[model samples]
Target: MPVDIPGPASSVSVQHEPFDVGAEIAAIAAGRPAIGAVASFVGLVRELPGCPGGLSAMTLEHYPGMTDKALEDIVGQARGRWQLQDVRVIHRVGRLAPGDAIVLVVVAAAHRGEAFAACEFIMDYLKTRAPFWKKEETRDGGHWVDARDADDAAAARWDV
Candidate 1:
């Protein structure tokens, strides 16, 4: 299912190859006169202790139907809360190296504040609400990365 706003153009895809942040930002702003500012964020895998040597690779998994719906809901909330021109979110799944890009978020608006706030809001919501799970491969073995309670707290701050 496609997740996009009703009036503005948006693109969301799951890809294995590394995403070009510059290109995606350009695409979001191209030919869009209403968009005066674009905000973006890219998350990368990091090496963390606790599992043998460190994280060598990570795999992301999601429940097919629920994942898309959750992402759409997040985008919808951003639209309702801000005057955004467009939004895009792309998350990668499968084996990824330590430096690989995990997800990308972009928001466009007529002003910088709305674009920035909405972009951060979507990212915070995704960290907690998205149905995706991460499994890290360390020197010892593989284990599912537990979601932190702090992430949930961060998302809750936006709620009225």
Candidate 2:
């Protein structure tokens, strides 16, 4: 689900292809001299601990329009709470193998605190609030993933 958010220093999208982290970061900083700090987080697919064998891959799916909307809402919430100068979120969908990049979050602000907090906030909220679904593939078999309780707890800290 490709997202279209206009007139703000933010861009969010869900795609079926890999992203270039360096390029994305450069894009965020281009023409934005106000940004004094930048923070980034990249999520990768890997075998869950205790699994019989390593995870071969993961298949991610999302409801097109809704997925983009939900991400936009999250970015909006982060912007409202922080002094952010720019933000970019890119999440990949479709089939992906272990070691593949799954998500990228880049945030820029006037200070490190704002950049770090907003980046963490967006990733935490995205884990719980976003509409994407994931299924894991292993040598043994494959199964749809269940939400983690820890993710919920992570998001809860920002309730205030």
Question: Which tens-of-lDDT digit does each residue in 1-160 have in candidate 1?
Answer: 3322234443566556678899889978999999999999999998785555788899988777677688878999999999998888888877899888999999999999999999999999999988889998888888898889999898999983
Model 1 worst lDDT window (10 residues): 1-10
Tens digit of per-residue lDDT, candidate 2, span 27-65: 888898898999999999986788978788899988788
Model 2: weakest 10-residue lDDT segment is 1-10
lDDT of each: 0.84, 0.89
Best by lDDT, which number? 2
Candidate 2 Cα errors over 4 Å, as ranges: 1-10
Highest TM-score, which number? Answer: 2
Off by over 4 Å in 1: 1-10, 49-52
Structural similarity to truth (TM-score) of each candidate: 0.89, 0.92
Which pairs in model 2 have colliding backbones?
none
